[model samples]
Target: MNPCFFYLLPSLLLIGFAFQSFGEAYETKPLACVLVEEIGGGGSSIPRTIRQTPVELHLIDPLNLIPEAPITSSPETLHLHVTDPSGKLLSPRLSSCEVTYLLPQEVPLAWVRSLTEEKRSPRALGHPWYSLSVKDDASGNTVSAVLGPQGEEDDKLTVFLAVYSTSATLYARLGDPLYVPCGFWRGQQFRSAIEWRHRALGDGKVLYAYDGRLDRIEEIFPGYEMNFSTLQSQGNASLLVDKVAVSDHGTFLCTIYLPYIRAQRDMQLEVTALPTVTFLPNPLFARPNEEITLSCEASHFHPLEISVELLRRLPGDSQFSVLPGVSLSTHTLNKDGTFSLTASLSIIASPEHHGARYFCRVRHISVPEGVTRSNTLHVAGVAGLSLEDGMYLFAVALALYGSLTFLHRKFKLVIGIHESKKDE
Candidate 1:
């Protein structure tokens, strides 16, 4: 064989081996290239800026997120596997890829999960810079890409993590003030429109709306004056419900539209009702030993946190005493969602109890410091007369009899005298 043939043969064999390995590598996509493409950078003269799609992350109500026990840094696992434009999974050795997470200041660093913890693969670039790196394998494969900007970023790929809708339940008296809050997490006061609607009637009645700029609140529905000045600065555009009425008890919806992103919150408002009290057996009359019951009825009230008490006040007493035998019966639910309660107090008629004022008192949580009272019941003595009154009646009867006899005798005498005169 010629000397040149030997050299040429070895070179050809090496080239064939290299081409075969390269073909095998193409069969399985490289994870690093996928990451680079996703992060708006691909090693090419013409940069391929992937159009960053806005992500809508619906979160639970922050108010309800308070952990019952001490909080610890436990990141939720995300089974993330990058894919190519053709929807093919990259290499399983994504372990060799370097990953960086860019987040807005609104989101906490603790909220992010570290993907490297599993096999000690990906590494983060330390505080303030959420950059993670995956070490290259012995075969020399590595991944390097930045997902989003590091800090103070307002560019595309801005993750929108917010509470889609905050659910809240509030109670107020029929005439008390009501405040419903629209919670916008962090300072995400993007350009948006605020709308408040009453969904209770299923008509979606508009209560208020602030257009493109929150310069002033326009009361779409009359009789509502809402304030939204702090919306731009604090992201809290709360609705102020003044002099809440029973008709206002229902579901309310608050909507914030940022053109690209839309959010909503729901609130259930319950307007508490005050009871109307009526007394049964008004102006009660009974014999000395008769048993009588006085009932206090409280009707048309809400949230059944009600109680009825029977009380008695003496003629000269400054304070009334609660009757021991007073009892409260189960409340009845009315068709209008209001409740009715009845309380009764039993009494054995006596002179002392007679002329005593009795009434039923209704108390409820809605009325913090006030109570409703039924009509006063004035107790009359036996047969509308006491023993003393009967004695007086007897004495008056005797005197009337004596006077009648005297008048009769005088009349007879006068008649006799008149007859004699006539005869003369």
Candidate 2:
């Protein structure tokens, strides 16, 4: 023997021992296995033999088996094992096995390589099939089985992995612009359509639809807009609402349709409208010892639950206190789907109430910190004559006195002229 052969002999033996041990270990216990038998094919009547041993075939990372995409940059090894029906190691190992690639009718099997470990790049349009044929050494029996895309032979498995994510909640303030995001992978040269539906309305109303052209249902969903140019270039099918309303609060469904493929995603929208708080008849004036009613209203708010507090701040106090005898009205629904409420405070006006400030503090889901509107009270005396009214009366009396004095002087002058004329 040559010196080189002697030097490489140990390495070769070690490699062979490692491979044999790996095969034995794989056959002894497989992660999973399925028993399969060959059926008649090619218009021939062939008797099928049920094999006891199960074949274990695994496609690691099946998600990467997308058509037109390279299976991997590097070669991927396929691990196969033969085990008995009881999941025990077989007595005699398989003598030979063949792995075949069954291509679609359009693509010939000769174009792809037939190897246990190879980089496979399938055609863009069709499904590639795999088959394993094994022969037991002891019984001289052969078994062949077709491995998955898990359907009938005639059914095409269109692999679709969503490129976008959903199930997130979005918040929008009332009357503000809102954008609902949805995206998908646009296949090459395929006809596609996008539809947006509101699931909260219970009618599944179509807010927007596009099929090579924009379909605007203006009567049902006004103020909704979409850009087809962006959708085509960026695969973005987001819906834009010019103004979000209370009716828009709910789950929305976006569906994308392609040839033999339909993808859908759901999103939630929460619309909040802050309450509009104001006091009715501000700068109120009341007479002492008289009963008066102060009204504060909160309007155009979303949801039915709200809090309206009537607060009072004495003339000298810095902090406000909740006013007594405050009554709240029932929530009134508006045509626009918002709610309104009125809070009233009744009190007997006295001198002590002069220069007091009353506040209407409103709290709602939209504004947790609350909003307050206040009005100042002006209490008049028992006669109900305010300072401005007394000033007005004094000015009127002064003007009357001046006019009477001028008229009296003119009358005296006229009498003197009449007496002089008579004496002459």
Candidate 3:
């Protein structure tokens, strides 16, 4: 054993040396890294450039990577991971980490649900799936990533986006139709559908519906013709309503359901009949206590109801209300649509109040709302002479009477004297 030790020592050392050499060749290496963002690098030869595809990039970065092989001394070139659609090596110049890459295609970002929490998946997917990978030659670091809806981005799809339109709420004359428009998105690869709904009100259903999805206008209504035209986009999914006719007034809603989205808008329609008012001629003249009648009649009302009032331009006042001057009086209108109201204002022989004008106003029966005014009448004033004027007039009259009597007597006496002398 002692003799074999010297001989075996060289062999053992040679085997050890060979093992260490092999280990050195396969040893793990520390990767050089420069912190960078995973964007910028499109139109790249690398089909999976991080700049082009988001899914292909590292979920988190500056993260450690196991060396594919030892970075012995220093590497002549950088090694990175990437998927080539053609399955070949790709070479390209990568941009600095600061720049951003634009989408490769135009994508529609229309979805209703997103209006709430604001889902931007639809906006991010403004293009188709692409690849991305990053390689920093200066720092021996490389990463490859995939981008865009890898499996399902529920928010990115617009296949069945819903749209709708509703008209302003308002009241319309009887036989006027309510306008409502329904719409949905036209998909890139799927067909769209639409239908109807309603709640019954009168003899017919309260709501009206028709399908307007055709090249030429088509009426799906049972006994009516509902038309469809365009009203320019108006910044929403709203479409113009076809002209309106009778039988379409009521509360109605337009609902649109797309492949994966649904939306709706509601409209209320009110219909009324033509309004009519009839009023009697105004009074010629009326004293304060005169019985003044103002007759206003409304036709087409089942039961007639009229309100009579007086308008007075008082000596001093601001606004108008019928009261002591003239006021509202009620009169029931007969089914014949004729109704009259007599209002009495006490007439004073002579009023102290000046320029007190009184006029009768008639609100027709049938319509509780119509009012008419009569011609204005003035309140007459009394002479109102003072005691001083009576005294002056009395004094003048006494003086004149005394003078006339005295003159007459004197004349008679003179005539008598003359006669007596003639007799002697």
User: What is the lDDT, from 0 to 100, of the residue 81 in candidate 2?
Assistant: 23
Question: Which ten residues in a row are the worst by lDDT in model 2?
Answer: 107-116
Candidate 1 lDDT, 1-424, residue by residue in tens: 7899987998999988876664443344223321222444446675656432222111111233222222232233221222122111123443433333433222111111111123332122222222223333443332222222223432222223222222356788766777776645322344456678887666567788766443444446755665656765656667887677666778887765542234455668877988888887854656666787777888888876887777778757878887786777888988766789888877776766656677676777677775745333333443366555566568889999999999999999999999999999
Name the 10 consecutive residues with the lowest summed lDDT in model 1. 107-116
Worst 10 residues of 3 by lDDT: 53-62
Q: What ordering of candidates by TM-score runs from best to worst? A: 2, 1, 3
What's the lDDT for all of these models?
Answer: 0.54, 0.61, 0.38
Q: By the lDDT metric, which is better: model 2 or model 3?
A: 2
Q: 243-292 in candidate 2: lDDT tens per residue? A: 98888889877766543334466678878888888896665777776788
lDDT of 3 by residue, 11-83 (tens): 9999889766544433323223232236444666645424221221111111223234433433333222222
Candidate 3 — what's its lDDT? Answer: 0.38
TM-score of each: 0.42, 0.51, 0.34
Q: Evaluate model 1: give its lDDT.
A: 0.54
How would the candidate models be sorted by lDDT, starting from the highest? 2, 1, 3
- Off-target runs (Cα >4 Å) in candidate 1 are 1-76, 79-167, 183-189, 201-204, 213-219, 278-285, 289-293, 304-363, 368-424
